[model samples]
Target: MKAIRIYEFGEPEVMRIVQVERPVPAPDEILVKVYAASVNPADYIIRRGGNEALKPLLKLPMGLGIDGAGIVEEVGSEVTEFKKGDRVYGVPNYLDGSYTEYLAAKATQFALMPRSLSFNEAGSLPACARMAYNGMVEKAKVQPGHRVLVHGAAGGIGSLAVQFAKAYGAYVIGTASAHNADFLKQLGADEVIDYNTQKFEHVVSDIDVVFNATPTTTVDEALRLRSVPVLNEGGIFVCTHGVWPSELFKGLLAKKKATVSMAGVDVNHHKIFTEVAKLIDLGKVKAVVNKVYPWERAAQAHHDSETKHVRGKIVLQIYQED
Candidate 1:
């Protein structure tokens, strides 16, 4: 089997395709023939050795993907939920990675792929869609007529967040570059604010939920702080990137009696994937795929993801799906 691996952490150039032995399913695992996988910010972050807390988990010559869509080739005796030849999609083990020809992981990590989507499209949904679902449905508890604001609305998780908020009957507002305003609207955003031309806090007020879907960075931290004043009384601010609110931002939330919440997709929960698949099949949600790269071009995909300007998810076609 061919897989993308990084022996040493550095640039995108550090990633390389290498031939390796295929994996066998364990007692509770399934072996999947991967069709496609999506590149995420976490992939690049891990490629660059990750943060101090994540560094200890690093093993040299590690694979580099989180989520993918595929056909099951075999299932272990304990895995009765899936059978051979079933189409499945979800997050594989972080250590195992999904950028490979074959993935063997716990069957509980996957669910049936959406019936209405292609392999590439379904491959893009697990990570971002789960995060969006967690933020909008679980943390923020979006309701009808609620004003929901999503930062970095053109990117992978943000795009999905907008759609999830809309699906829950919230009034969705998105902030992105001028180029993506129309795109955000197409994703069901009720309003799109051009972040380059205007500040979101100055234009939007009394927002019921402010979902910060941007990558965790110094600039994004500042942007997260700016959203504090927009929340309505007792509103929730959801952070999807693991960034906690600063003391100043916390003080502002205190005045409004609002609170900040952190959200992360629980890949082990198969029900989340099943619910997202339902939304996709019903036409209420769609994967926002920006580009598809061949498996050999995994390095280039990492480079594109590092730009942080991609409109949506970037996929790697592992095997051509007939």
Candidate 2:
């Protein structure tokens, strides 16, 4: 099997496409013949050795992607939802590998690929879509007519958040560059603000919830939300990047009379994951694929995602379709 591996953390060059032994399914796992996987900020963060907290957990010469779509080549004894040849998609357990020709993933982490989507589209859904669903539907508690604001709306999780907010009947406002204004609008954002030219804090108010999807490095940009009274009494602000520390964030929210919650998608959202797939299958939700790179170009795909300007998900095609 061929997989993308990082020998040492630094630049994207450290990521290499190499031949490796294939993974075997555990009792509750499934062996998938990977067709495609998506690049995420987490991928670059892990490759660059930036996530020191996760360092001990990441095996050296580690394989690189989390979200993927593939066909089930084999299923473990305990698996019941899927069988051989079933098309599936989801984020592999962080310890498992997805940027490979084959991956053995926990059966619980995956769902059947939406009937309406292709491998590439399914590959784009898991990490970002799960995060979006968690923030919009879970933490935000969005209701019809709620006003939702999404920062970095053109990026992967942000784009998905915009659509999910609207799908839940909230009025969505997204912040992006001028080039992405139309793109956000097409995703059903009620309004798109070009953050480069306009100050979003000045133009919007009374937001029921705000979703922060920027890379965790942008502390200043994330903190700036506090300057606005976007949240109503007891309203919540959801941070997806794990940006701020607990005590300080709690104090800040207290001062503003708002509550703050931080989250990353977990196994708890399996039902939402299935619901998202149902939406896609019904043509109610869509995967916005911005680019596709060959498996060998996995490093370049990471580079593109790091630029923080991608309009949607960037994917790597792992298998050559004949």
Candidate 3:
């Protein structure tokens, strides 16, 4: 099988295509013939060796993707929810990455692809959608008439957060550059804040929720902190720092009297995707794919994700549905 591998970390160029023996499924696992995968900030962070500072050292020959959509080729003895030939999508245990031809993971990590979506659309859902769901529904519990603020609202997870907040009946305010204001409005944000010209905190305040969609490295403390006073009492602030909130960020939350929670997809990828699939099938949610690349260009996908300029999600087409 072919897979994207990183022997050492530095740049997108550090990722490469390599041939490896196909993995076998364990008793509770399923082997999938990958159809598509999405590029995430974590993929680039892993490729550039940034994770070493926070997590354990990256083992050499690591794979480079986290979430993917594919057809189940074989099911483990204990698997029951799906069978061979089922179209499935979710984040694989990417300790080895999902940028590959074949991946084997515990069957519980995947769910049937929403019938209303294509392989590319379902492929892009797992991580970004999960993050959005985590922030808007789980942490914020946004309800009808609530005010929700989504920072970096044109980006992948941010865009999804905007939609989910709106779907939950919240009045959503999304922050982005001027070019994305119209796009955010189309995604159902009640208001769009062009951070390039206007400060978000100045314009959006007394919110029920604030979802941070910026990468931890590029997050502006002043802009993000300004949101502290912008919240209603006990409002939730969700961070996508790619890790837990920093001690400093935590202290700000404490001082502001707003509780802070790091954004996270549910650990049970299957269950969450199943819920998201219901939204997809109901036409309440859609994957905000910005670009699609052929599978072989996994490196290029990583490069584009690092640019942080993409409006929504980026996907690598591993195969088309047959």
- Measured by TM-score, the strongest candidate is 1
The CA lDDT of each predicted structure is 0.89, 0.82, 0.83
- Models 1 onward score TM values of 0.97, 0.94, 0.94
Candidate 1 to truth, TM: 0.97
Model 3, position 45: C-alpha lDDT score: 76
CA deviation > 4 Å runs, candidate 2: 220-228, 245-249, 255-257
Q: Which candidate should be chosen as best, given lDDT against the real structure? A: 1
Residues 75-110 of candidate 2: C-alpha lDDT, one tens digit per residue: 999999889998888878765668889988788888
RMSD (CA, Å), candidate 1 to true, equals 1.3
- lDDT of candidate 1 vs native? 0.89
Query: Which tens-of-lDDT digit does each residue in 206-300 have in candidate 3?
Result: 79788888754556565556788788877888877755656786687777677987778445677778989998899887888989999777777
Residue lDDT tens for model 1, 223-304: 7678877889999988887556688888888898999888783533477889999999999999989999998888888889
Steric clash count of candidate 1: 0
By summed lDDT, the worst window of 10 consecutive residues in model 2 runs over: 219-228
Stretches off by above 4 angstroms in model 3 are 52-55, 243-252
